[model samples]
Target: MLSEPTFSFTNFQQDAVKALLSSTGISLLAILPILILIVRQCGSAHPAPPRGCRRLGLPPGHSNLHDEFDPKYSKGTSKDVDDKGQPLWRVKALFTHPIKSCAAVELNVADVVSTGFAFDRQFCFAEQFTPDQASTSEEKTQPYWDARTLRNGHYSRLALIRPEIWVPDPAAPDYAPDLDEVRSKGVMVMYYPRPAGRGLSSYLVKLGIALRLLPRELSFSVPLVPPPDRASAYPPVPVKIWKDTPVAYDYGQHLPQSLREFLAPPDAGASRPLTLFRVDPTHHRQVFRNAPRKEELGFQPVTGFADAYPLHILNIASVHDVAARCARDIPRLSVRRFRANIIVQGPEAYAEDHWKRILIRPTGAKSDADAGVEVHVACRTMRCRLPNVDPATGIRHASEPDRTLKSYRRIDPGDPTNACLGMQCVPSVQEFVIRVGDTVSLLETGEHCYIKLLKPGEIVEGV
Candidate 1:
């Protein structure tokens, strides 16, 4: 027989005070002077409230938006302009998939208040930890495992791969769901190397040497451990791994001969080339020279990937422009190394590279006038080396025999070899649908604004 436990307010209060004193007394004492000095310094610096604090009509040091407004705010002025200073038609598209090379869900109605998206990268697959090995007795007895615990610099290789797994089915109405059901399914993972080496198979081999957990060949058989069970625990939902690799876009210019030939047909007899773009290797070299090293760069150690702060935006138009320069009907341009989030379709080739601000909205969602959630494009997307690959075909674009016939063709007898036909530098708009569109007006409270361009060679601030 069990007796019911009783609580008294007096005893509870006494116990609470005792616990607080025991746990925080030393910390509070040590931190009090530091806090006081910080407050005093801040008070003397402005004497008046900071902009965010003033907006709330609070005291100098008080603010409701403190948690919301980051110090990086107030770096620039918002603009409202059109392509030709006339109202231009614009639509917003949101790429719900933040991770590169993953399927994306487009939305007509999205909310972007202050942070990025309402539901951005909400789920991810967890790579198994070494302790998760079945051979380990300690692992067998542990009832649960945390996916985050498995993430560390030692496990950096996991960042290169995205496990092909499916999202777990939500708990049913009648019964709690078993989270492990999703993990039982095998996952498909791909790897991208630091210097852009071979895919997952090779990278795993290198990682195996670093971790000494097992041979690279054994990585496929390992099972990921689950997080410890707690009331507040919200395990990541595993996504299904499609056995086939998704179509990849390489932004870097270097391409392997085999891939290029596969994409480009020797003559018109071949099927339409699959759409792809190659990055300019020379350009990548320049970018890499200026880029900061890993130690100077900020990254999420757990994910082993660079943080989203310094996002790299690639211009679809730029790729289109480069493709147009090549012989007509060149099957595919390679874009292997450059990893990007949202690939846009518009007029200015590489126009996004020169943008100071951009806005993304859900398709058919009411404009900012109606919804408060819209993504604020903070910085320009930078360059990376993932674009270089051997052209699928053995022939180079410039070396093809078709170049002689197509390069000399004249729209009119008077047209020059390098004539600007309004089509030469036109931005490439791929056929994919976007839930959002880019914008120049960061302060506009409504939709239907025009796109504006930033100065060329202007490095995005803080990136």
Candidate 2:
């Protein structure tokens, strides 16, 4: 009788299915509220981050500096009637030096910033010779001397050290995840020619480099823009450039050992400790002389690590004139030897000498109304023995260009004893783009007498 009661297979299956369904319903009801909450959250837009946070994590190639303004405008046609039937003056070449006294970065397109080109003379190599009296107690032990340039005889090799700027591109497939980190922080990969092996090997290696057969070089990178996140890492210290003692970010601690060793080999006699320094873009070191008055400029014309003005514009025709004046045996002179930020063609020999104001129209700009950049041609650029050092070989020439230039190019009334070639300029617009084919119109011309404005009680040696 008990076995017969347990033999209802169909009814037992129905009861099992009903029990499973009841449990499943209860579980779904319990999770329904959580599921709805998640869906609502996913549909709603995310709140934007704070401005400061956004700046720290800005999109690649974007900067948040208040002074660095990016204005929107159309690049007009290059043809303009201002040429007045003369040969149209056009930008033949554009050059920027990420590191002062180093090889130039020739560009077809360059962004003009408040401090001249986007990255011109932003970084420089300096050697510590003596502790400064102005050093704070904490920094006194590791004090650094004033900034040194390629003008120093031993630093002639600096010309051989080439620097290349790398701005991250997020669109690239191999793009780094840390785009903002690389952008604001800046990246400058520098290469230096190095001798490999001995005699034949060394010669072969160098020949290969010259002939595009092999690369015998050493390279290292440094931050072109000082990282805001690591502001504390690179402490602000007073560094003298000429007579002005502006605070600069000292990258001495982070200096790569390989770079320091190469620039200042221990074997070299009495070599000072070499390190890199970057200008604080925020620091307003006004260009006192050969610059437009503050009222005329709207803002004070300032410079970073430049000898005097924000820009140095050279005329290729003038360079050719200089070459013609040089000894017949002398090789063809390169415009690069002058280290100009802008080089123009179609201008007569030394025609820039009388230029007081110039307008740089975009390649497609037809007139000033079509969006153009104005620059105050400040004064004539004074020359030193620096140009004597060949940019290609880093070898100093024995009285060639410099000697010839001094003979006839000493035309600056302010410093007539010194040779002058290029015209120092300051851009009127804070931000704009200048291209290789852009038109250069001499807006106004006047006799410019170079003058150095001195702060009260400050004495400049050998001026």
Candidate 3:
């Protein structure tokens, strides 16, 4: 027979104080500050690991080397505008994703389309799972994207292929990689599968080497809107697009058989070959983008594979602020984790939060609307745990950004726990080219909203 344990408050307090003064306790306290200092040093690295990384359960000895954010990218600054302030802020860096959740393609200049950036999130690889895999792992309970044959809708479900976007190191002896070389030839990517029966946790863990999906080896690009003959031959596959159900799209096997077999499991479990698709140019999947939902201030809200709005912007200052706060917890805090379309070095941290509308004009263009690109800041970007996953390693970090973010930015009522970082923006000027050096001018301001309110059955893909 076991006797009940008894506790006394006075006795407990005495023991606790004695324990704190013990040699073991004193040694722990002495090293605690030192351990914290070393970990905070990791804040300088790009593509950092999550807080308490040990709990994330990543593969052993994951590589930590990654390309640093270009100093030139720290190009822009902001000054207070008095009625009329000279264009103080400019586009520091521009990253466009030709495919959804793949590597980002850096661009010197990019054109804005009706939806957002041209070809941004325009292409995505859809996953097909057997009934068993779908039932066991996927969001089968949800009414949308609940197809065993094919699923497309959110990054939460999408298998994000973490291919290294930039390889800063040189391949040859006595030679260094040039910035020009990195811009031209990105990096090689290798695809490997997580252990079988691991389920969603496996997808969160990083895997893969740098590789490019090009025209060679069965990898090819098709027009956003395929030809009539081609469209008829491979008819549109009905998909659940947010509240809009049954959107038509042309689908095909974008990966070669060898690559498919490489990522396939040896166990021969129930799973289908990966299939890729692009936004149907015919339908364009026009969304009611931007605030108030009146119609993006004369511009249309259309998306290819983006979660909600087409454009997602991040500020270096904001990232720096977050990194500073949580550096002690998170080893490596980088802007790459947030993965914004445009990275601007603003006047102050979170300055972009107040911007309702901005116009990007030529460095010296006259005050003319037709001469520049205009974007309407949509809403504060609601974040998930993806940030904890390093872009280079594909391993999830321990609950850091989320933990620290919850401390201050827990303002989202829809999902109060979901923290926000960057602001989502949509193009108001339909078509225009935005360059890295383009100047930014505030066009309007308004109270920031917490969520992108949708109808009963609406959903989106993360950018």
Q: Enumerate clash totals for all models, in the order shown.
A: 62, 5, 13
Candidate 2 lDDT over 424-449, as tens digits, reads 98888777888777778878998988
By descending TM-score, how would the candidates be arranged? 2, 3, 1
lDDT of each: 0.30, 0.70, 0.56
- Tell me the tens digit of each residue's lDDT in model 1 across 280-331: 1122111111233345323111111122322233444444454455525453
Top candidate when judged by lDDT against the true structure: 2
**Which whole-number lDDT from 0 to 100 does residue 248 have in model 3?**
45
Better of 2 and 3 by TM-score: 2
- Between prediction 1 and prediction 3, which has the larger TM-score? 3
Give the candidate number with the greatest TM-score: 2
Model 2: colliding residue pairs:
76-364, 76-365, 77-364, 77-365, 78-364
Model 3 over residues 204-276: C-alpha lDDT tens digits?
Answer: 2221111111111112223334444445645666454444433445455335554454334445454454655
| Weakest lDDT window of 10 consecutive positions for candidate 1 | 421-430
- RMSD in Å for all candidates: 27.2, 19.7, 16.8
> Can you tell me which runs of candidate 1 are displaced by over 4 Å?
1-165, 171-176, 181-226, 229-304, 307-312, 326-331, 334-337, 367-378, 390-463
Stretches off by above 4 angstroms in model 3 are 1-88, 129-228, 241-250, 261-273, 289-296, 367-371, 452-463
Candidate 3, 405: how far from true, in Å?
Answer: 2.1
Q: What is the lDDT of candidate 1?
A: 0.30
